[model samples]
Target: MVFKKLLSAFGVGGPTVDTVLVNPNTRPGLALDGRVNLVGGDAPAAIEQIVVGLVTRVEMESGDGEYAGVMEFHRLPVSGAFELAPKQQLSIPFQLPVPWETPITDVYGQRLHGMTMGLRTEVAVARAVDKSDLDQVNVHPLPVQERILDAFARLGFRFKGADLERGHIRGVHQTLPFYQEIEFFAAPQYAQVINEVELTFVTSPQGIEVVLECDKRGGFLSAGHDVFGRYTVAHTDADRVDWVQVVDGWLQQTTSHYGGLRAQGFGAPQGFGAPPGYGAPHGYPTQHGHGGHGHGHGHGHGGHGRGVGMGGIVAGAALGAVGGMVAGEMIEDAVEGDFAEDWGFGGDEE
Candidate 1:
């Protein structure tokens, strides 16, 4: 998608900018190739700089409650100062390197419920209002990550929703200030004890750190609480292991006796080994106790009542079963509305 806007700061005869993405679909550790096209209006103008960044909506906790806002996490400068003559046209090509820990916005061709991502372009003038544009961005999952997701579907776990939380996961390395949580309703076999499961993936060149937060059901005498589990898997293991069995084991270990595992500070159970050069055992505290300043309840964008069955998901049915079309339209609207307001570029600048 492409977005074009006039330089409002420059007044009537100001320059205009149009950002065009070569392709919107990409994965983590990849690059989004695009060009910024500029056209002079009726008069010449001095261009200060041109930049592009990745933006998304994140749920943050406040004193009263939680609110969602747009945030730019990664940016790259495309061009420096330059001069444009009357009616002159120029194009600046750029390659924006996606971060290794970038969140996934799409799975199999279906947009994930409650997830939205975009690439924003900003062109600053010497003393004029900066012109900006935004285009939707789609990020797919890595092979290993996809395998794990498929495993969940095979296990009868239903897709509930997903959202970005403005906080870090304890005992995990993160380049950004927030993390993505893919939530799922519990499968029938484990519904007796588990209500839902939240999954997080922190990726690197070597491998990925998988974090699981399980919401346990209350027992006759015990109160309900959240259990945390962490595991390490290599990219090469994407095709080597039976992901169904592995994920099932992880769920069993996590929901059964997470207290003992937390005390031991261990990695995955025996037989599931971490790749060479992997870090030490990852120990995660209870959900409410960690995350630096405590985690907030996420307000997902899509309706939470809709449920996506495992059979449908595994068969390539639209994963956005919870009104994906509506969610997609909402994403586009957010790109032009929420992003501009949050970035402080929609109104007058001081």
Candidate 2:
């Protein structure tokens, strides 16, 4: 009947799609294995295409302020146009290669707070509303990253929070459109000189560039300002040096340089043309027991929330409890709602 055609056009008789990942856990430069299971509905239909994309939340800077939304960084097409008979079932296997620069979502077997990742499936049919499915994904840190994080834990710095910032650092080689900042509160000894520290890692096939931003407290004579530091480490450097000492030295150098800058009349704070220390502050030792200079710091913008937590792991108890809730709602919208409309991916065919 004519009424039946109207109902089918509105998805009442369209195909349903479900994506199942064999293993949701993955790492950078790896492949995600999964299958798209489809069940045809009340009437035969023509499926325009089936696409699987890796989507995650990214914070972007706008005219007035910043806003966060889901973005599909990489996409893979599994199937093209196909005819589906009513009630027919089809299974399509796929292996999606995750990029080497994928932001990490889990650390030390625990989910990092303020991070979310998912796999989304988009199925477009001839005359029905498109349907999608989302699956949470876990991306673990690389070996070098793990060592540095564990070192932070060993150094008494507590994890605060993490977030993705849109923009590229001046001196770092960044492959992705954005970068991640993992923040931590200052330990007792450094508390008087600094408030918190934000750590960022820009990775590449050759090595990883580690950036540090230390927020210093104001002194009796000088105003407070953030100092930056950057360090480069090879993937093979894991287990080769004492990261605790290296990190400590970097922090010390970053904080120590303020006195010299202040004396040089580098008086203004951020946004007022304050001196951004591009290398180890002038006179601070840049080397550890091993030789080679660590990267220095400079001024930048934007960050996320902060909190207290146990050794190097981001505010564990509360973060572990609330992570699922945050990811659930955000990712649900990404897969179910208007993807193109929400993320400004205009003209990207479903």
Best by lDDT: 1
Listed in order, each prediction's TM-score against the native is 0.78, 0.76
Which ranges of candidate 2 are over 4 A from the true structure? 258-312, 315-317, 320-333, 337-350
The local distance difference test score of each candidate is 0.68, 0.66
lDDT score of residue 324 within candidate 1: 10
- Candidate 1 has which clashing residue pairs, if any? 9-129
Q: What's model 2's overall lDDT?
A: 0.66
Q: RMSD, each candidate, Å?
A: 11.7, 12.0
Scored by TM-score, the top model is 1
Candidate 2 lDDT by residue in tens digits, 110-197: 6677777778888888887777877777777765676677667666787887777766887666667778888888889899989998
